[model samples]
Target: MFFSKLVMAALAATVLAEKTPVTPLLLANFERYAAFASAAYSSDCANPPFNSTVVRYINDVPTDTQATLFRDDIAQQFIISFRGTSDIQDFVTDLDQVLVPCVAQGIQCPTCLCWQGYLIQYNAVANTVKSAIDAGLLQYPGYSLVVTGHSMGGALASLAAASLDGQGLPLIAYTYGQPRTGNQAYANLIDSAFNGTMYRLTHTNDGVPQIPAQSDGYRHHSREYWQSDDPPTIENTFQCQGQEPSDCNQSEPGYGIGNGGIGINAAHLSYFGISTGNPLDPNAAC
Candidate 1:
């Protein structure tokens, strides 16, 4: 009787913990950082909330490798965020995948064909981030590292995060509109590697997360945070949905495909807690 009572108490406590809301400040910061990741110009880099210094900015135009490294002194953190697809090259990258040696050891995984373009970019950027971390820690002690991106950038961030896995630091990744980066083996590798540190955020009706299609054997990391509103009028509406193959993303009706064509574009651009402006509007037709 006593043990049954204790189990019920513990379950109640867990439920209470899950119901606890995310703070406004953290959500605001995520918005700012995500927007910062999507920025295209040096002028766009002027974010006041962060006394941000751009450590490295790479724009190998039209090939889906536009990434930036910023040291946020205000937050005392380093953010490595990638920008999404902007041209034909990015689309090509999405279509291209090649089988590479599995990242996890002793796992006789199937032939996994990871995103080729993201793999190349991750290799180069991972080295830069490591070097920066080694140097930055001396300059700014106790600073944490955050990896983030949108769309194709998010895919690259996932690959980069996997590469940086097992490093002796608490790493956090927040990716938006990120499509699948690899097969089941790669997804499992990330789950084991990053564990609880990776958060994949998807907005309602967002089509990007639904493809390069899971039917192709691509899978997403667990613990997805879903936004169910358009323009996101309220705060902290994001709910934690655990993994795919359940009722998340394409699994739900009127979300992945039901949003229609415009919905997909809107979902990709809006980061929910962040701005609602379309990042593709300016150059959408250009």
Candidate 2:
């Protein structure tokens, strides 16, 4: 354990140094990306911001998981979103925490290992999501891709972002109340791929990110945007030092572990003061 901490300390230093060079985040964009994350819950996608964008499709054929694809011609971006846990299937997905090989075609992670359930969630819609993204890109040339999700949807967003990285597509991921999706190698893969563009936001006392337990061989990727105080605001948020930084959300005992890795807590429910819905309506049906 001592030697492991030393290694992680050295790696954290290196990751932090290189992290300064990535694209700058616009605080205003947090609200925008968050809007998309929340929109994933609305069944009809008739929410305010979503209503304004060109809706591509909402893939929920499995009913267990759902992802949304849309185009913002004004911003010239193809945005994809996944809804948080609203079904028993998603809870089952979250509980199936066994580590597995990330062998999804196009992902270059030869040695990477990921949480089984999260990868399954990603695989469920990977083909359709990619196809929609490809079509959207072709239709709107020069537009980049953005992926956002809350809770389990956040886990899917990470997998989707990694998948996009494999395709060498321009992309960014903003996930709220996300869990640890993989091991150190998997986290490193994502950190290297997006540098600063991977916004893994954690709200105060959010239990989700605390498990698939780090003790179980899962490690979060570099950088964490933490809301250290309640009533989350730009002023109260802090960009943490490195992957799994102790000074940020890691400072508090999260919701996931206390419930034995299941059950929803308030912090995991609403991000940026928006109700992402409960188990009854994972998608807000907006």
TM-score of each predicted structure versus truth: 0.75, 0.84
Full-model lDDT, candidate 1 = 0.63
Superposed model 1: Cα runs more than 4 Å off: 1-26, 40-44, 60-64, 102-113, 233-236, 251-264, 273-286
Candidate 2: regions farther than 4 A off: 1-25, 48-51, 60-63, 253-263, 279-285
Candidate 1, residues 1-286, lDDT tens digits: the string is 9999999999866643442234565456556656655653232454522557777666654344666678878778887777676666766766665546544322333664576667766665565666776687778879988888777778877766665555665678888877777877777777777666787877776777877656666677775666556544335335453456334445446444312222246566777555422543422211
How does candidate 2 fare on TM-score? 0.84
